[model samples]
Target: MSGEMTQGCPPTPEARAAQRARTLARPGLEAVRVKGRLRANKWLLLRRITQLGILALFLAGPWFGWWIVKGNLSSSLTLGVLPLTDPYLLAQSLAAGHVPYKDALLGGAIVLAFYLLFGGRLFCAWVCPVNLVTDAAAWLRRRLGIKGGKTPSAWTRYWLLGFTLVASAATGSIAWEWVNPVSMLHRGLIFGFGLAWGIVLAVFLYDLLFASRGWCGHVCPVGAFYGLLGKTALIRVTADQRRACDDCMDCFAVCPEPQVIRPALKAVGQAHPLILDKDCTSCGRCIDVCGKDVFRLTTRFDRSES
Candidate 1:
């Protein structure tokens, strides 16, 4: 104890300064490493949760085949059929040949009504069966060594939407709903007694094995509709950085939608750090992925960032 106390009793000025610097630097480096590890774990957990949820829903929804979950001839007859099974109805209504306001309009109105109430979040984050199926496919794709991919070009959805409307107009029956895997699977089971389910499941398995949600972000008409409506929604999640960013670009790399990340990057280090746009699904993944705690989803809207 006497020898140790003597050694620690005093230090040269240079040694003390060196020791101080080491102490400060160690904490900073450790903090960075800890933050990075935590961020990685957070995203990994989020992806796992989303994938499991999707798998559960896909396995359960059709297995139960509840009337509310399963659309049938009634959906075709009363809800306005489209070409897949009720195409004649979708066509008649869209073409102005029949009053969609009276029949098919009910579904569309119900959708629009929900959007107005909840800010159009349902189709993307909740309601769409195709989205659920595609999420599962994406999870499988990741399991098969596909690490990450972006939604195709922004205009992809717009073109698809236009094409769907035009095709529906031309055929005098909407066809988008027919090619829809969700609707197709439903009809396949009801009409072909699960043959449709088998074929659809095969396609889904293929998508999972190869591509990542190839059908949802780029091809789904309903997603396009929700996207358009979501543009106007009042609630938005965004990134915020009160301090100077390190410019590590970790947030951008982890972002699911790169286009929106670009703009967010431009705003960083400036007055506004979080300028979110239409591409944001508000999934909050970015928030979880930011190691420096730069991203946050807050209701306090700042116009400068917007």
Candidate 2:
């Protein structure tokens, strides 16, 4: 008190006003209200439809006795003609020294081709049933003001991916499916919701309270495998209209993988605005949140900035 100023009892009027402004900046859906909610949420709505529709296809076969698709997410035969298999699962089987049937090999090849062209993590955003639970948790986390508790390194999933293969080799069987939430949820939906509810609820709670994006973003080996497949994907999200960005930060808040946005959106001297990161899930949340329409889905070859 003799030579220095004492701390104030409370923040000044100007500081309070600045704090208020910062709080208000978290507009959530209001960030896109000016663009019309329907237009802004178009991608989100489409994604929901795709996710539910795929689930319906599988459920229809078992529940309604309609065999449109005759298998779980791991492997399936559509209309008894088209076979689809999870390439990741096939890799595990091979690691376990199990040679898959010819149909399974062909199915994996077909799936590998599709993901190679359209982006692999598209499965996470558009098809996986567990995504519904995680998205709901994320939504509730934001509304409840629950900041993430702890975030693990994103590379943890890659290590887990390797562990899955090594575990398969060591056990001489596909081991991850024993605890994979996606497989459990799918089986629960088809069979009965016994232990599946516990798995799904655990994931929901994990993302809601434990970490911001703990599962798909940090732990899921399946997602890690698919992300590697998408390293050279043809389809990508591009910040085509990045010049129109007004620094709103809404996209960053909504993106599951925010790190992928920077290089494309703020490439000071770079001519292109393509989000080329393999980790991007192509979830379209960025497109849904940006009021300026700064982002869009396009092929990697089309790099002209808007």
> Which candidate's lDDT is highest?
2
Please give, for residues 160-213, the per-residue lDDT of candidate 1 as tens digits: 777777777787665576565656654554455355566567657655654355
Q: Spell out the clash pairs found in candidate 2.
A: none
Worst 10 residues of 2 by lDDT: 1-10
- State in Å the error of residue 173, model 1: 1.1
Give TM-scores for every candidate, taking all chains together and pairing residue i with residue i.
Answer: 0.59, 0.91
The total of clashing pairs for model 1 equals 7
**Local accuracy of candidate 2 as per-residue lDDT tens digits, 1-306:** 001112444555666555344433343445456678787788889999999898999999889999899999999999899999999999999999999999999999999999998999999999999999998888778768787398899989999999999999999999898899999999999998999999999999999999997898999999999999998898899998998865556787678887888999999556589999998999998888777778989999999986
Off by over 4 Å in 2: 1-31, 268-271
Q: Alpha-carbon error at 89 in model 2, in Å?
A: 0.4
Query: Model 1 compared with the native: what TM-score?
Result: 0.59
